[model samples]
Target: MKTKITLNKYLLVSLLLPVLLFSCKKFGDVNIDPTKSSNLNPVNQLVFTQLRFAGDVTINERTSIIMTMPMVQQISGAYYNRYGSTYIKNKQYMSELWEIGYPNDVLNIADAVERTQSDPLKTNLNAMCRIMKVYIFARMTDLYGDIPYSEAGKAYATGIVHPKFDAQKDIYDDFFKELKEAGNSLNTSKDAVGQELFYHGDISKWKKFANSLRLRLAMRLVKVDPEKAKAEVQDAYNSGLFTDNTDICKVDYNNITNGYAEIRGNGVSVGINQYVDDGRPRVCNTLINEMKQTNDPRLQYIARAYWTNPDRLSDRLDVTDQVKAQVGLLGVDAGHYNYDNFLGAINIDYPGRGTISVPNGGQKAQLADFLVRSDAPFFHLTYAEVEFLLAEATVRWNLNLGGNAKTLYEKGLEAACTQLSLFPNGPVLTSTQIQNFKQDNQLAPGKELQTIDNQIWVALLMNAPEAYANWRRTGYPALIPAITAESTTTTIPRRFEYPLSEREQNAANIEKALTALGGKDDWTGRVWWDKK
Candidate 1:
């Protein structure tokens, strides 16, 4: 009887065990949210990455407007602008790009590239990802030398919580290789990428962009590695480039006011417009004066001003009145505009200020409405830039880039002018006006390189980082460093310092990078390609 009872208990326990285990498993699944998944769609990931690249308000404000734009002397007259205009160190502004770039743009794009690598159906998507990865890293390495390249964006896949910073030289080499491979890999016969932001999955356009970017990167090597630069430029040119304005790589943003978190609106436009009443930036005399001196037709489209009264919204005067527009087209001298005495010294009178005596913040020109609208297109790479690079290569290396330096230079100027119409309500430059400007601004005999780079400077107006990079490489337009009592340094900053977070979280790798940088992590240090 005892043996029979024991056997029956064992048999019943065994039967219940499987049922209990299955119940626990089902309960575990209930805790997991069905709406959330570990797997990411590569197409959606790519779209998000592209949008964040152009639509990060923090980056646009801290890096571009406050730092690069003022450093390049394109725009100024804001208190925050002192960081670049007067060479004052603001660690927050200096580190924003590195801090934001890695976690957001780098991580997502890297994942997309990795996920699509083995899928046969995702060939074009993979190619686009590769090209975009290069673009993102190039901008990063250009600004902050020796960032984590190979090991970046691999935290989830490889458990690399801390990535090693690769040398800029090695990174550049990889950039060229990746661009070449990606450009060649692009196939129209493959599945079209529905979520592409820059080109809408247009394989041909993507191909042109990749090569044009290669040409631009090659030009950066002029002072560092001329042999490599020439070879790369020749190869990229021969491969094919942007034939016209339509091939320009850009993001046309919608007029959305959902703040920085919203990716549909242009972050740069939102950034600049936020300070419309306070510390509003006026076009720098360096830029406006250059345009005025050259009789550049784009000046009318690029700059405008209003008589502003911060106290009253309705008190602003429109630039449509030709008389007021002419008077308000004044560009402020950067470092000099911060003083109270300087503000008092300006004798200009605005009838719309309610009282001409009040010197409301509108004493100087502001960026035009069309240029700063929430929907303005952010130009990533353009045919104008490609033409200018080719022109520079022709002059510097005597390479046959399908046209003489003069012809290419004029084509760049026309393309630059023509692309402005892409902006919301942007003015159209008539063919005659473009031709007249081209005729007047022809490349000078002794100053071919200078002329080409100066126009490159003008063409890259809103894209401040690119303009700053070009200025560093070519030293065109001959900017004098801002001389002010408030300045922390006499020289312009060559590159951004590493983020403070790197010091706290990734100390060892950052220390290794600092050692390579001669044991200092300051803006004065030059990147590899920016050799003096």
Candidate 2:
């Protein structure tokens, strides 16, 4: 009877032990918490990450209006206090770009790097991150003369709260080295198993993109470091680049919601369609006049005339009448009356014949429908850019490119004109229209390089940062400075002022940086590469 009791007790313990073990076992749901883990594989996270990095037109309102678009005269709008582009806007306009880039690109990419490092399958993913790091940092340094590059995004690991500011030259050098190494390290066999939003894990396309970007950076250093630039160009050429428009680097926004949806910046806020919105920022004189002079059909495709009212758009107006009526606001701070007139100028801001009599209601030229369309793909890089750069490099530096400048220039024009149709739901420009534009706008023999850069600028519309950087690099198209700028006529901003937040929190580092920034963190300070 005692032996029987012992066996029964042992059986009860076994049953309870199995149940306890099962209860303690964790499911994936229990372990996989986004708040706790640094898993960078979530598709949604990648989608938003790309959006943040690529940026929407709405988010870039301040800088675009105050500096890039208006200064370049691609588009025009008013700064918060400044009426239209009449006066120079302060540094606050540039503050948001600096605020967003480091956190989104550097820190986020760093997180992705950490999560991807140990896994062999993520080789392509890791390499892509390295390339993206170059993209963001390049723009960052381009905007601000010096930024924290090498020591940035190391706060968590190395306790580097106040990272040392890296000179733009060092940053560019690092970009060259990193892109070269990272691009070469891309594994075609190993898929991008992480959050591969842009290419959807296609390593081949990623490789092409990497090489093309490297080429662009190489050309950026053409004036500053000729030998290095030549070598990089050759290397990039050897690596590969986008063969066609199909290979352009674009971030699709079709499936993702833009973060800027809640905060639509100041504007006209009305539109007839996705292609021609009644918004604050309208096509500037520089863009529209150029198109008009060339009789470019793309003008009608891009700009809309709000005449009569939103109601008149429904009337039987042909493309001819609409094109004739579509006019952008001049980039001058006219007096209150003139400003009122321009704002209320029929076909100016509000679509229907500038009938917005009230100062409160008049529209400045906002972006066209295609630009404001949420579903439009955010272009990162493109074959058109590559072709134009190649044309410039060959002509300007006499690089030993197999392709001639004329052919490359024409190809660039073709690519740029044809590819404008990428913005979905917008008018698809006809082939004949593109050919006519190309024929009518031939690159002049003496002004081939200038024309190339100008075309590049035109292609870079809405991509204000690149346009600004390229303008700094190659001062083409003879852009007029802000008419009422406090700055000297000879001076346009070479770099953006460092943010106020950096001034307060990272005071010491900022102080040290100001020394390199010529004892003043002013926009007049030229970056190392910007010898022009």
lDDT (Cα, 0-100) at 476 in candidate 2: 76
Which tens-of-lDDT digit does each residue in 369-466 have in candidate 1? 78877677899999999999999999988998999998898889999999988877788999999999988888878999888999999999989999
The residue ranges of model 2 lying beyond 4 angstroms of the native Cα positions read 1-46, 56-59, 79-89, 254-279, 308-366, 485-490
In candidate 1, which residue ranges exceed 4 Å CA deviation?
1-38, 309-316, 320-328, 338-360
Residue-level lDDT for 516 in candidate 1: 62
TM-score, per-candidate, Cα-based: 0.89, 0.80
- Writing each residue's lDDT as its tens digit, candidate 2 over 1-532 gives 2312322333333223212212332345654432323333523333344545544334355555446655666755332323224435365667767775565446666656666667777677777777777887787788888888888866755678899898777888888788888788888677644345567667778888888998988887867888888888878878888889989887544322323542111111211121222334445667766667777776766665332223222442222243345433332222111144444334322355443322222333334555545445667898999999888888876776558888888888888877877776667778788788888878787988777888898888767678888888888777765545343334566778899998988998888778876798777788878875
In model 2, what lDDT does residue 286 have? Answer: 70
lDDT of 1: 0.80
Q: TM-score: which candidate is best?
A: 1
Error of 2 at 92 (Å): 2.8
